[model samples]
Target: MVTKESWSMSIWPMAPWKITFLIYQREKLLWIGIQMKVAAGAAKGLEYLHETADPPVIYRDFKASNILLDAEFNPKLSDFGLAKLVQLGIKTHVSTRVMGTYGYCAPEYALTGQLTSKSDVYSFGVVFLEIITGRRVIDNSRPTEEQNLVTWASPLLKDRKKFDLLADPLLEGNYPQKGLHQALAVAAMCLQEEAATRPLMSDVVTALEYLATNKDAGQGGILEEPEEGEEDHIEADS
Candidate 1:
C-alpha cells in the first residue's frame, strides 16, 4: 500500500532514481501526460509571480533546492526571504551588501549590488541545468574545469544530438528524452549572459504550456514521450 512514508522516495528529491523508476512503471501515453502537467504547473507558477503579483517580485535565489514537490510530484517555488519587489520607475534595486547563494547568484549581482528580475532568471537557468543534468549547481568532486554544472553542460545543450547528457545517470534512460531537451533549451535561454536576452517568465510559461499541449497531441515536441511501463514501475509504491 502507498502510505505517506512509502511515498517519500517517489516524491522527495532523495535518489532521483525513484522518479525514474516511477516513469518506468507506466506506458508512454500515461506518464507523459503527468510529466507535462507537472512541469507546466511549475512554469505557470513562475509566471504568476512575475506578472500576476502587484509589483512583480524577484525570486533572487531560485534553485531546485527551493522547488518543492508534492506527492503528485507537482513543482512549487518556495522560499521568498530573498524575494524583492521591483518598483516602477526604479531603475534598479541597489544593496550595499550583496546576498544570495554562491552558485545561484548572477555574476553581475555578485559583483555589484544591482538587483533585477533578470537575476532570478539566471538562477532559474541554473535550476534547469540541475533538473536536466541531475547534478548540483556546484560539484567539487568533478575534474577541475567541470565543477560548475552550467559550464560543463552548456556545450552539450547546443548540440541537439548530445541532449542525452542532460538525463540523470540514475534514470538509465527512463525520462522522456525530447521533453528533457526542450526544458534544457528553456533553461539555456534563461542562463544567457545578457539579462535582456532571457525570455520573460510569462513567456516561459506560455512556451512550456505550448510544449506540453503539443506533446500531449503527439505533434512532435521539445520533450519526448515516455517508453513502455514507465510510471507503474515505481517500486510497487512501497
Candidate 2:
C-alpha cells in the first residue's frame, strides 16, 4: 500500500490482466485523456530506466499489467526480474533467452534472443494498442481474424478511413478524432517491425505528455479508483 496526504494506493494482485481491465470497466470508463496521462507516466518511468540509469536498463518485460496505478491514476512500472542493464558504450543489445509475454515481444528480439530498449518499445506498443482499442494482445475467445490485436489492427492503422474502428467501443465515440489519429501514429511507430526504426522512450514520453495534458484529446469521463485490498502484479512468462 502506498499513501500520500490526499490518497492511498492499494496494488491489485491479478495475473494475465492489465490496465485495460480497469479502464474499460462496465460501471465507469477512464477517459482517453486520463489514459494518456497514465501512458505518459509509464513512459517516463521507462525513459528513466533506459536513459537516466547509470547503466542503461532494458525493461524486457514492460506491459500493462506491470504498470501500477495510484489513486489518481499515476502509473508506475513494476516487476524488474527480467530487467537487464546494458553497457551503453560497449554493447548494442543483451543476449538472453527469450522471455516476456508472448504477444508483447518484439519480432526481432523474439527471433534472435537479442534484447534491447526497442524490444521494450514493442511491448509498450502492444500495451498502448490495448489502451486504445480495449482489446487484449492475444485473445483466444475472439474471432481468428481479430484474435491477434497487432496483426488485426495493422491494416486498419494504414487506412485513415478505418481509424474509427480502432478506438475502444466502450468509449462510445467520446474520444477526439485528431487525438485518436495521433495516438495510433505513436503506437504504429513503436510497433515498427525493425527495432532500429522504433522511436526512443524519450520521444514517446514527449508525445504522450502532449496528449495527456490536452483535455480536448478525450471527453472527460468518470475515473475509477482502485478497490481496497487489491493490487496488480506482473510476472514474466517464458
Candidate 3:
C-alpha cells in the first residue's frame, strides 16, 4: 500500500497484532507542511475505518501499538482481532467477552458487552489525549486511581488553566495557545464518558482537518516552548 514515496515500509516483527511503529527518533521534520499532512493522513485513515470499511469496522482495540507508520510518518491503523461490524439495522454488536487494552477500552463497553461505533470513538479520544499530552495511556507511576489515563486527564481537559499542566513537559510551551485550547475541546468531546455525547469519527476528522488547515496559514506550534528533543506523539492515530 505504498504511495510511492521513496518506498520504505514493512510490517516486520509481528507480535500479538499485525501493526508496527515506524522508528522515528526525536524530531523528523519541523515543517508545518509535513506535520499537518501527517495529521490529516491519520484522520483520513480513521475515517475510512468508520465510514468506508464494510459494515463500518469498529477498531474495538485501538491503541498506540495498533497504529503502524510509513516513511513519511503517516499513520496506518492495524489490528482487527477485536474489530466489530455493525449491521444495517442493528443498534450494537454484542460479544461473549469484552476484549481491549485496559487503558484504551471505552467505559460503557468495558462495563457492558455491547459494542457500538461510539466505543471506537472513546478509544480515539484516548489516542487524542496521548497526542496532546505526549504521555502513555497507562503509566503506573501515578497514584492509585490517577493511574487511569482517561479518568486523570478528563478533568484537566475542561479547565484551561489546568489543561496546560497535562501538556508534555518536553514541549515546555512552544505552540499556539489558542489552538491548543481548541484541540482540547475536541478531545473533551471524544472522551465523553457517555457514548451518546461523543462526536462521530467523521466529525472528529473534520474538526482536525479544519484546525490544521486554519493554523497552516499562520504559525505552526503545539505548545509554548517546543523542545528540540521532544518525543513525537505521532501514534495518536493508532
Q: lDDT (CA) for every model shown?
A: 0.65, 0.75, 0.65
User: Top model by TM-score, which number?
Assistant: 2
The lowest-lDDT stretch of 10 consecutive residues in candidate 1 is 8-17
- Tell me the lDDT of candidate 2: 0.75
If the candidates were sorted by their lDDT against the true structure, best first, what order would they fall in? 2, 3, 1
TM-score for model 3?
A: 0.76
Write one digit per residue (lDDT tens) for candidate 2, span 88-120.
586457466788888899998888887878888
Off by over 4 Å in 1: 1-38, 174-177, 216-238
TM-score of each: 0.71, 0.81, 0.76
Score residue 4 of candidate 2 by CA lDDT: 95
Ranking of all predicted structures according to TM-score, beginning with the best and ending with the worst: 2, 3, 1
lDDT of 1 by residue, 45-138 (tens): 6677777877777787776566655666666676677888788767478878898898888877888878787787788677656655557778
Best by lDDT: 2
Q: What C-alpha RMSD separates each model from the true structure? A: 10.2, 10.6, 8.0
Error of 3 at 68 (Å): 1.1
